[model samples]
Target: MKIGFIGLGVMGARMVKRFLEAGHEVFVFNRTPEKAEFLVKLGALRAKDIPSLAEQSDVVCSCLSMPEDSIKVFLDGVIPHAKSGTICLDFSTVGVDTSRIIYQKAREKGIDYLDTPVSGGPEGVENGTLTIMVGGEKEAYERVRSLLNSLGEKIEYLGGTGSGSIAKLINQYLVAVHSIAASEAMVAGAAFGLDSEQLYKLLKLSYGQSRMLERHMEQYVLDRNFEPGGAVKYVHKDVKLANQLFEQAGLTETLGKLAENSFSQAMSIGLSDLDMSAVIKPLEDKSGVVVKK
Candidate 1:
């Protein structure tokens, strides 16, 4: 299949490589021309701009950073140039309202738009094991199932339009809360003089275990390797979006708000570029104990 991909950031670049390795013809564009150039050398075609890429693709897939960016790309770059019947999939974590607005605009132009937010971070992208939550027309979803399968281990088609965004927000809410809880638990355990590695093993087998504990704590936090798997800044955006959903739904407060504040503090202290596990640093600073092996 001829696929046009926009946004070549951490996850986007890896996904484009997956498509290329699977023998699909890929056309790629990025704000940074150098990122697109790197993909071009790996057998993907370099698109001068989004419109040109949309014009030539059977399926247009975008993994942008912000909802505003997704809006601009579809409204200004895609809808104008993409042929009728082109399927557009947005894999960004965006608000439900934003996804629905874009969906309506795409429908007006006869383009099928799916808010297909993904989980599993960059590791998932590299391993072809992402969990893709899709929301759009059933027929349109079936059309891209094979391609989605190539990129993920789990692909679920929710109801319509913004359903996928809602699902992804819920997923990210849990991720944020769990990541914060995991950090707190690990930091507390370390402060109490327990071996970090031993405590992690016990937590894994206990009721307190969570995926965040495994990914954020076991893999990165305990080792003190705060390299970016999913950065704090991006997770901050996602949690804030989740908080917006809570506010719109008339909820007084959510645990996501707490995670948002924690991530915000991490960012204020200059930890935005580090891994989401770096949220532990502020706690470490306050307690004077390192949650390391």
Candidate 2:
């Protein structure tokens, strides 16, 4: 498949590489050229911009940051120059409303569009084990399934238009809550002088285990490195979206509210660029008990 990939951030960079490794001819672009340059060296042609990318590809995939970024890239760049019948897949975790709007707009232009957000982060991308939840026309999804298989271990057709976004929102909600809950648990352990390492191993063997718990245990409990698996700013956006979704549904989520507040507070303390596990920082400040070394 001749594919155009836009947005070469952490996840995007790895995803493009996976496609290339799968023997796809990949044309790549990024808002920051340096990131894409490395992939360019690996045989990805550099697009002058998204329009050029769209003009020369059968399929286009994006893994941008926010809703606004996705809109800007597709609207200002790809949509204008996309050939009729090109399939555009967005792997960005964006809002359901925005996904519907993009789907409608893409169809109007004779392009096939899919909201195909992913979970499992950079490690997942590298391992080709990311779980992809796709929402689009069933025909479009079937057409792109092979290409998607190159990048994901598990791919599910999640329905139409905004359905993938809805699924992604729910996924992010749990990610935020679990990560913060893990932080609180670690803080509790510290207060009781329980060995943090021992407790992590015990929890992993117990029902308290989760992907976020294992991921955080790497830096927070073990090495104390706060780099981005999922960044602080990104989780802040997801939590805010979850709150909006809850309000729109006329529902209340007190626990979700607390998780949002915890991540929001972490962002407030200038930890926005750090890993999502840095949510532990605010709780650390409040309790005066840091989680291990």
Q: 240-263 in candidate 1: lDDT tens per residue?
A: 999888888898577888999999
Model 2, span 138-168: residue lDDT tens: 9999999999898889999989898889888
Q: Model 2 misses residue 218 by how many Å?
A: 2.8
Model 2 Cα shift for residue 121 (angstroms): 1.2
Over 4 Å off in model 1, which ranges? none
Q: Indicate the worst ten consecutive residues by lDDT in candidate 2.
A: 218-227
* Strongest candidate by lDDT: 1
**Worst 10-residue stretch by lDDT in candidate 1?**
215-224
- For model 2, what is the alpha-carbon lDDT of residue 176? 90
User: How many steric clashes between backbone atoms does each model show?
Assistant: 0, 0
Whole-model lDDT per candidate: 0.92, 0.88
Clashing pairs in 1: none
